[model samples]
Target chain A: MRQSTFNNKFLPYILLLPTMFILVVFLFYPAIETFRLSFFKVHPWTGATRFAGFYNFIKIFSNPEYLHSFVLSAMFAFAVIGLGLFFSLLIAILLNQKIAGIRFYRTFLIWPYALSPAIAGALFNFLFNPANGVLCYFTGYRSWLTDGRTAILVVIIAAVWKNLGYNVIFYLTALRNVPQAALESASIDGAGAIKRFFYITFAFLSPTSFFLFVMNTTYAYFATFGLIDVLTEGGPAGSTRILIYHLYKDFFVHSKTGYAAAESLVLFTLVVGITFLQFQTSEKKVHYQ
Target chain B: MKQVKMAVMMLIITVVLPFAVFANGGVDVDESATASIEFWHAMSGERIDLIQSFVDKFVAENPNIAVDVQYTGSYNDTLNKVKSAYKAGNAPDVFHSYEIGTLGLINSGIISPLDEMADKYKKDIPWNDFFTPVQSYYKYQGSHYSMPFNSSTPLVYYNKTFFEEAGLDPENPPKTYKGIREAALKLRAAGHETPVTWNLHSWYFEEMICLQDEPFVNSDNGRGSELPTKVAFNSAAGQKVLEWWVGMEKEGLFLDVGPGWANHRAAFGSGEAAIIMSSSSDVNRLTAALAEKGWEMGTGYIPRPEGAKGGVAIGGGSLWMTNNHSNEEELAALKLISFISEDESQIAWHKGTGYFPVRKTAMDQLKKEGWFEENPNYLTAFNQLLDSPESLNTAGGLLGIFPEARELIQSAIQEMYAGKPVKKALDEAAAKANASIEEWNDIMQ
Candidate 1:
């Protein structure tokens, strides 16, 4: 790796200043403030705070709905990551083939990447809505939104569908980078197609997979708030209430800042713990070439 | 910039100084009294134009007052904007909030009570001429805290065309819970899959409880000096409302469109549902929507349970004056809201949108113009309001934690739809609401 030398130390510091300022202001300051807020009881309108010493934490922890949301969010994140990556990789592989109008297919397949989650949710909502829905018309008007389990599935499907284009884009790039020489040699050496893919291509894709795993986890945890909000609004008996959605209702809708801060802390810790676990276990298997 | 600041300072002194002196001594407001103030509102779409039209008229008439009107998003979004703006010390001189937000805003201490402002400015608002229900809803601690602009109640909107097709009388819409069910059965037998739906909202729940003349909260429906410690939504009245609601869903007679305002309207507009309980303000939109489908829409008071004697509570937004503005700006905002609520503006607003005219005089004006006879659907909303007996329950509940409680009740309804027993669901919702109420009280302390 070539390293560039800076002519002036002050110049290097000045170059770093803007990003550092943003980090402190947008990220670090809020994190510290949230941590502090988690321990207090906050008046919603007046913005007054009183030190409550674990009251807010205890309140959320003891609530079954909050616990349900926490578990639901974790499961939802994993489901999104697993299904999003699988379908996208499959589609990416197919699109990589030299077919007629491949460029057109690729462009169309990746178009959903440009859409925000709320739009995706709205589309899915219209298609599957029980009353006069286009997809509901085909499904004999089965009500998908009113049932708890199915509503969660609907949200998951919407989230996965919204995210597929992004995943496919990255996977397509990774598939293209797979060395043609190694694949040809493996084929010449009598390796079957499946064996070649597993032994060679899959190994190279691990690094990309690891990168996607982290990104998708973050996306599932955070990015799906808008999708869930628009589609279900954490309803059907709060079955679709993911942690971020619950946090939003608490902080924004209900105006319970202290409780929301405590909830956010839990969510933050859960995401961090998952990412740390992933790095510890999955990072070891990544084959960086 | 320094010179500009100096000019602004001079302007404030020259303009505001005399206004303060005149405000203390003079009975008449100076037409030349100049003050620029921002008015943030939650009304979107064409209503923005309607609001601007009247405000423009007011601005033209009072040439010195520059009103910067902004269309902030929804009621929730507008309140959030005000919160941030207030913390930043640039809150709007006046902003709009919904009916349910009355208690929280009162407790929020960010508002200048309208009665106090009226007293300070020596401007007597036509309180006696204002509608009783509308005025009482905003009266906190025996004082008017906000100016009621748009007052609405939920009404049962039925498709007259669908009713006639179903062999039900188009003129005689269902007026009771049992009547509604029978009407639904007739409509469904006539090949309508779902005969009814309302947006999955606690507003209907709250209204139904009120229709029974039952208080939603124990402390005089949170109208007393004591803050509401718990909700009455788990009581028999509340459970009865849910049982009917969830029962219709179970029998596949009601379409559950979840929360928010759109889906239920969509269901009714497309003839997927023949009857819907929605805001009185939805009269114009839903009527137009059904007309697009060549269906005639009818309006009725939202059906009550058998022998229920209570009436509907108001369900729209009001304009609140913020505490931070200068007296000059305050006086200007007062004038602006007063003008908006007057007979002329209220009549225009009522005709343009289905929201009720807050003033009795406006109602009389609309009646004199023969507006209701031509648009009888409009009369149903007004008659429903006039017919309502004044009571603590009919006045509507006030609570510092109403927003959270509303969500709890909405989720409980969803839970009931998911096959949870009505009583259990209401009980759980009430429990959670009580807990939140407790927490809010503690925090406010």
Candidate 2:
């Protein structure tokens, strides 16, 4: 009995040993090293390393550019996610109608997510070209990348466009999963289309909407990083400077690996804190009945 | 369970034994016939074709030796790849590096010291024949780390049509700071919306450094034991340059045509902008692209303020050998480097890439062959940079952590362009740059 118990207790760990080893090799070790390095100042170009005590972090916090990058990152995340959810929800409701070509509409809505972000950024760069861009033709604006206010809008538009399809698919699936009987019962009670959706359909889709809120927030902050890096490079004048862009510049461009690590850790913490806060605030409002 | 354990052990043994055997077998591999060297470089465009042809000829001539060349993205990307590969114990035998910040690589022992090899090959290399400024950019702590590869000097490229339209002499481009402003005003009057496009920010500032006779950093851009300290770019000369840019902005003549040389060149090439400051290496490609467009282009030496030093630094990359190789592999790599530095190879590279020849012998050959008479733009960089034979700044600054320093300078410039107070941007950049240099100094200590 003892032998069987011992075998049973150790077997799970034995089964998990490979995954643990892989994680240690790839993720855990790098994270630990990055944490250690955040306490040091080193020249990235020369590979010469030395220990520093919180100086890198202190410098990161003290620098105005780094601070600006953090604020911009948060703003970009919310703007992209909020705008994306609002539009995707609207599209979901429209497609939910028994309109002709409804199946075709759903497929078309999910198509943008199939393309790579790099390709998307490149295409948008061409479209926003000052001299010969399609948008430039309409707006009569030269040098779209440099204009401060418009540059931010351009990045948000690209972010929203790239993510619209994925959110639509998510919301559409949730809308379909909502109990038809609940929606029908509301309509049978002399409720109009708009009334039925707000009262019955919205409550049923709340869980999925909440789940998408968390997901869209994460995607907006992280996945759009490479797109921005390739596109404007946070430039014209850093009008579009974001957190991941700052981290990349600090690490690869500036060669301040330690400072970059500290910035990344702080960014990760902020993301986690915000996510937890969102969960705490919204968990009570979501209904499962 | 026993069978599974045995099979797992067998798999582990199978995986480990071959690597051990391969390591042991390396000593017995063929050495006398010829050692094949793997060289990774970042040169692309027409230059890639030029290098491929040269390597093909070299392989045909020296059947015993074979060279495998790989394209490794931009200079910055190549630097990162090489450094990471070195740490992982898998660097290529040879790679490309630039002058300014790469000296840090040598100091950190990522690259092999080429002082002894340079001495041994000094006569063959015609080291004295190389322009002194170009050579200065490659040496670290009085020791050369790599052969001078594609070398260029910063110069002015102007649209001839715009100059003519502005009632300015197309033959005479700006030769002084006052002249540039006057010409810009004329171009603006001629209906060019943006009269001046100052791309390659370093070129304009490096010229300003020369004009001011001010240093790029503390202790002569890190030539001595002094730390980099703060960036000195916000000096009177730097502010003057920034004010000049701001003045142009006010006049509606200044435009940021993207951050890179290619973008600015494209803007001007496409007729959106009038003048751009760039390396002479841009001439051939620009000429070829503009040839079909039927627009005349003009080339001139970079303008300087009156009574300012006028020598420009070299701006292209060099071939650096990594320490992650055997002695034999390094020697083979050196042979390839030596081959590329020969007259025929250098001339081919010059004609192909618009980069000036690094050797007097190659230049002499090209001159005799009528390359200059046929393509005068190719000679502009050589003539302007080699004008002074003994100037230290002419050789280019070799800061310990040069790329980072450039980044600091770029960030400061970006801030200034973004409308930050010039003084504040420069001061902040200087402080941050000093912190980085101090960190590098600490590591060296």
Candidate 3:
């Protein structure tokens, strides 16, 4: 490998200044502010402030509704990630075929990735609306969103559907990059198609799958705010009130700034823990090459 | 160099002049000077157009005052926007707020009481002409904090055709909870699956308590004190109401249409549900909707329990002046509010939107126009409000954390409807509401 050295070390520092400035201003500053706010009791409308150590954390942890929301968020994240990965991988494999009109199918498969989450939520809400929805027509006009279990299921389905196209795009690229020579050798050795896929193609796709696992986990944990807001607004006995939705209710709806800030920090910690766990577990399974 | 210096000076003057004018309060009380003001509201769709027409008329009549009307999404969104804007010291001169948000807004120290302005125009504005319940709802600490712009009360809407088919009298719809249950049974016997439906909102629950003359919170519904210490909705009256609702759901006579206002409206309009509890403002839309299906709709006051004696509280938004501008701008904003409160504008607003006319003269004008004769159902809410007893309960609750309290009550109601024990749910909701109230009082105090 050739080593290229810069004549002016200060040139590199000057070049990095804009990016560093942006990161500090936008990301780090707000994060530090949120941490600072978590320890204070602040009035939402009046801008009054009082420092109280661990009071917000105590309040949220002691509240049963907050605890329920935490459990519900975990359930929601798992359901979304599981269903999203399974369906997208299935669709990706199908789209990777050498059939005619393959390009058309691939383009169509990735189309929903371009839709905003709120629009997707609204679309599903209309389709599954209890009174005269297209799906309700087949189910004897049953109201789907009024039932707690069914409402959560509907929300989960909407979340998964909104994210499916994104996962399929990543999986498609991963599937194409799988070494064809290895699969060809396996085929020549009289290995079954499914076996070869599991041994060779699937192994090659593990790294992409691991990356998507983190992405989808974060997406489900945080990015579904618009979807839940539009579709349910965390209702039907708070069955669909995940952590983020609960945090929003406290922050924007109830205007409990300090409590909401505390809740946000808790959620941030949870996401960090989950990401750390995923990386630790993926060390053995994810392929480097 | 001279030309460049001139250009720079011109640019600085152009940019800084407006800021200076704005900083100087953006209004002049001189007879011929224009007092430009911003009016933020939550009106949308046809209501927005109606409000716009009124704004145009106000400007045309008062050439020295220029009013800019802007829609700020729903009531909740409007409150959020106003709070943030007030914190930033740039709130609109006037804005529309829901009655429940009055205490929160007042505590923010950004509200200008309207009593002084009302006193100034007492003769021309017909202050006494405003409905008692509507006017009293906007008053906090014995002074008016907002102008009651659009007021409404819940009413029972039923399908006359279904009532007749079920062998029930359409002219005498259910007047009590037991009566509704009986009617629901008959409707179901006549092949209606879901006979009763209501929008999943705590507003209806609040009305239920008010009908029993029960305070939703302590300290005379937070009117006697600035900060409410606790909620009082978990009393026997509340428990009785929730138990009846749960029983109706268990018996399959009630349908849960979820929290969307449109869903319950669709259930009733599509003839799937024989009866629904909804706001008086839904009169025009419901009539138009059912008219397409050739269904006759009937309206009645919200039903009471077997022996309850109170009536429903008013539910809707009010106009408030923010303390963000100069005296001239405040006076101009007050002028616009007074103009809208007059009989002409109130009559037009009531006719255009199904919201009730806050002024008695507007109601009388509406009656004179044969509006009641054409739409007799619209008279039900007006009569209910007129007949309601003058008590603290009917005045409605005022809490700093009312929005959160409402959500808690709604969730508890949903839990009860889903087969949870009514008392357990109500108690849990009340506890949560009290905690929120304490938190709000802690901060505000």
Candidate 4:
């Protein structure tokens, strides 16, 4: 690989310039600003700033609502990732079989990936609306969103539903690329279908699963803000108030930019930590081929 | 190659031409030059059509001033858009802002006070002609920051059919919380599934506080000599309101239809709820929807607790002009504002939308035309405002974090509904709200 590298160093750096510029300008700049903002109190409209060392962090950490949101975010992430991975893998495996209209089923399974989180939230909200909702006809017209526990459950279900298609698509692609001969041999060696799946096919899908775990975690952590905003608005006594939604309320609704900035940094650190931990533990078990 | 070059040139022009036009348009604001100004608002559907009609009329009369009206989603979305646009130095010349955001906009120093321009057009648009509650709610430190546009207050809307079925007089709807409970019990005994319902909005809580003659925050509801240092919403009056609400919930007299007003509307329109508390602005739509079902609607003041002395404060939004505009553009914006607030436009606006006419002359005109004779429900809000005494409580609270405070109260209410003790939940919400106020005051300082 070293020998095959371009002999002209300027050409490589020039080739990488666009991507590096993008990363620095879009990612690093905002991240650094958020870090700097966390140490100060800033006004949202007037662009005024005042220094307050660790005040934002202390205020947020000591607040019961913020702490509760942190816990709720963890539960939401775990539920989404767990349910998303399990159901997608099951569906992908079922869809991988050589059946008639299997392609149609696969395409149908991928349709949800096309819907944005906000659209999904709105769609589910209509379905589960207490008054005159389709689901209310079955539930005896009970408003599900008014209760804190059920509201959180509805948000989790929506989030999981929104992310399921992406996970299924990846898992399907990985399953298609799995070595058929290894599975056949394992089956021929008197291993049952379940045993062969666990010993052979499951091993082959580990890498894809690992990648999906990280992607879904990120999705649940940050990308579900639109879903929560539309469906619940972090309501029913803050049951669906995930960390990102909390940050958004403080920044936009409350105009507490500095506090929101501190929250963003905390969320960034949490995501980074989760990613690092996933890489550390899961990479060792992932199979390349 | 020539074709590609042509396509590239076309693309560049397509993208850059608008910027160039805007850049040139920004300059040359002379007496004869047309001052093209953008007006952002949260009006939509039928209301947007009415606003467009008025804008067209304004442009017809004042051809030199091209007024463009743009609908900017909901009120909260509009606030967010304005804040970002102000930061980017591209805010609209005029925008419709909810009254709750008055303090924040004033503190930002981006709003150009309308008092001077209002005086300039005193002959045509008499400032005193506007409704007192509407006008006073937008004033800060003795200066009016915005023009009272789509002002409304909460009203108790009941189904006349349901009231009659429940052996209650439709002409005499319940006027107090205790009376409502009694009426709701009768409604339930008459076989109504949900006797009463209201959207879970904190606006009603604020109105309830006013109805009880209690300040929502200290410093005379933040209209005193100095800014408020603490929230006063966790008072005994607030607790009493919540306790009654929770008691209704416990007895199953009131159905918790969740957050949006649409739910309450649906429940009422479908005859599922016998009585509902909603904004007076909902009269037109609710009447139409109920008329389709052959159900007559009755509108009354938002029910208060027994013996409460105060009245409901005004709700809805106001129009504001931004500061970063040329003199001609600012004048043009003011002209448009005055035109919208004029009696003729106010009558049209009030008829088109259920919002009360903010001008006394408009109301008089409507009365003279016998419009209220047919649409008596529309007079309820106007009568409520007129009956309200000029007190600090009815003037409504003014806080930089009023929106946030409302959200906190909403959360606290939800918590109480979910079985948290009323006082504890309110105290927690008040503490958090006070902290937000302090933080906001610190930033302003």
Q: What is the TM-score of each candidate against the true structure?
A: 0.94, 0.88, 0.92, 0.92
Off by over 4 Å in 2: A1-24, A41-53, A100-107, B1-34, B64-66, B118-124
Question: Residue B398 in model 1: shift from native, Å?
Answer: 0.9
- Candidate 1, residue B372: Cα displacement in angstroms equals 1.2
- Model 1: DockQ against the native? 0.64
> Candidate 3: which stretches are off by over 4 Å?
A1-26, A141-143, B1-32, B116-125
Ranking by DockQ: 1, 3, 4, 2
What's the true lDDT of residue B59 in model 3? 94
Q: Candidate 1's residue-wise lDDT over A1-289, tens digit each?
A: 9998878869978989999999999999999999999999887876778899999899899989899988898899989999999999899999989989999999999998899988988898888776666877887755687778788899999899898999999999999999999999999999999999899989989999999999999999999988898888888888999999999998888998998999889888988998899999987798899
- Pick by DockQ: which candidate is best? 1
- Residues A270-289 of candidate 3 have per-residue lDDT tens digits of 99999899999887988879
Residue B16 error, candidate 3, Å: 46
Per-residue lDDT over B337-423 for candidate 4, one digit per residue giving the tens place of the 0 to 100 score:
888988889888888888888988888888999998999988888888888877888899988899899899999988888889999
TM-score of chain B of 3: 0.91
TM-score of the second chain of model 4 compared to its true counterpart: 0.91
Query: Which pairs of residues collide in candidate 4?
Result: none
Candidate models: Cα lDDT each: 0.89, 0.75, 0.87, 0.87
Rank candidates, TM-score, best first: 1, 4, 3, 2
C-alpha lDDT (0 to 100) for residue B393 of candidate 1: 88
As for TM-score, the candidate ahead, 1 or 4, is 1
| Residues B1-445, model 1: lDDT tens digits | 9999999999999999787767557345564678999999999999999999999999988888999999999999999999989877899999999888888888887889888788777778888898888877877778898899998999999999989999999999999989999999999999998889988888988999999999999899999989889898799999898889889999989988778888888889888899999999998899899999899999998989989999988889899999988667888999999999898899889888889999988888778888888999988988898899999889999988888888888888887887889999889888888888887887776
